[model samples]
Target: MAGTLHFHPNNLFAPCITNLFWFKLHHHVMVQFKKYVESFPVKPLFIVFTVLFFITPSAIASVQISRTQILMGDVPVTLVVKTAKKHTIKVTRAMEETFLLGKKLSDSLSEFSSASDISRINRSPSHVWISLKEPLSLFLLEKSVKASNLTEGAFDITFSSSNKHTSWADLAIDKHHQRVMKKAAGLKLGVSGIAKGLIVELMSHHLTKKGFDRNLVNAGGDVYASGTWIVGIRNPFSPEQKPLTKIKVKNKSVSTSGLYQRGSHIIDPHTHQALGKKEAPLWASVTTIGNEGPMTDALTTGFFLLPFHKIESIVQQNTGFKVILITLKKQVIKISH
Candidate 1:
């Protein structure tokens, strides 16, 4: 069995990187072999085979699985995972565990359009103590409030609900009793901004915990890549499905939000209406990279509504965060910290 580790880094500059990588590998191999083999009479054929084994790709032991299912209304939930060699069973079980975990969160967070625990709470009368009975819903609310506060209501979900006088601060959580209650009658919880990304985030964590390292979880374009992955940002209006650009991610999470594809669902938390100009929005696309699901998703949505300066401020304050905004005027702005 070939047990040597192999490295493959695919990206925009693949040829250049590959050449440099291979050169370094060969140099190291030759130098090490010359040093060690000089003390012994080693066959030239033996050195050749040793070097070949290290250079050859060992994908025979790798496994990649992708499955798309109807989840969270009409949105397609896709999970793609690539595992190390000889770990097919490990990858499969990790998939089952992560998807099941994601489904549980999705079912609970499907309240904006579907009936759920959070939805029932939204439908309840004023001051009703909703029994979440699960930590995920509470987590959603916590993240929602945190994002709303961080963005200064720019990423507000409470307003997106067809209710009135609801703010992130009005919601009260009884951590001791494990329940939540709204102060006003019209408050509703919407999780669209953060839910999908969070699912991918949780799935990523689960995969890591299960000892599966190389994987990619794309919850409707919001991605959490455990290892390296080349992700294409699909053009919204292009029927050809061409990627606007490719991004290479390693142990990172990325999200792209736009007035394309599911643009109808992206709502301005303040106006509680779908984003964009109905025909053309001020900004056509937003791409964000980071590690946290809640932050990446919420920030992408929030940045869509924010001015360029505000977006700049955000990137400056947060380390390891980068954003690219493309406007309707064909201007592209990139911010990183």
Candidate 2:
């Protein structure tokens, strides 16, 4: 019978043929090795069996595991780690510890929690110094304060207060003393916008300390990638939820603040209100990549509120920062420094 042959690399039949060829080659080699061993005074047959039984599978197989859950009450957190099968238990244990660490940090920073340090700051009387006991809380607050300055008040933690005159400027932060005081009464501050990124960054650091060579920590739209990872940006207008683009990042954080992710949820600190269609920028989504997750997260939110020219200026000022702007009309613009 005449038969047609298919040998395309992408086809299933090609793999079968390749496996058969390798099997025959291996069999022939083994037969020759046996004959040679018979001629030798002593044979090392156990060495060959050990290589086939122990090392072959280990060399061919690797393991990847992931965990996804809603962290910090509402934010979605995902952890992905890759390693050899032999270290599966170690990686899993590291992931569990990382999750616990994230939860503890979230609880400490949560403004809704009466026991939280932030909530205590909100409840404190004006002009009274409150010593921050937790090191993590102090660090986060210091970072938030710095972010306000970096973004020119566009990334203020106190942006949500009903009092328009009260802002981050009204708060006195003493990082050296580990204390803070609100100069204006009812000047409530919340780090919900930037806290997720901070948590993810710390989680990534913990995983690295645990000896995970390849890992990723994603909290909502904020992400930190260790080693190399390809992350996808979602198409906001796609009904089928396709990726708008993909970017490879190594030891960096990529954050996206978009209308698609939250739908007019970003409040303009300047106006003390949600960004209306008219008030919003021409870009529907603003993504920023940087070495620090919190900064990238803050930049994305700040860029979304600022004009395009202003955003370009900020991107230029920051070294090693990259911005991707997706316009309302679906045009993509990139700015890198």
Model 1 TM = 0.76
Off by over 4 Å in 2: 1-54
- Predict model 1's lDDT versus the native: 0.74
Q: Report how far residue 205 has shifted in candidate 1, in Å.
A: 2.3
What does candidate 2 score in Cα RMSD to the true structure? 8.3
- Tens digits of lDDT, candidate 1, 1-337: 2233444342111222235566577667656856786665666777667666665466455668776666656667677777656677767777777778877778877776455667877777778787875677788778788777767787876765456556777788886777888887677777777888887788888888888677777777688888888877766556267777677878888888877655666776666667654534557788889878877888888877888888888789868888888777656677888
TM-score per candidate, chains pooled: 0.76, 0.83
Clashes of 2: 0
In angstroms, give how far residue 255 of model 2 lies from its true place. Answer: 0.8
Write the residue-wise lDDT of candidate 2 on 1-337 in tens digits: 3334544343222322235566466557666866876786545676566456766786757788898878899787999998878888989899999999999888888899899889999888899999987887787877787777867888888987757899888989888989999999879988887878888999999999999969999887899999999988878677257779889999999998777675487877888777775575556788899898777887788778777888888878879789988899988888987
- What RMSD, rounded to one decimal, does every model reach? 11.1, 8.3
Candidate 2 weakest ten by summed lDDT: 9-18
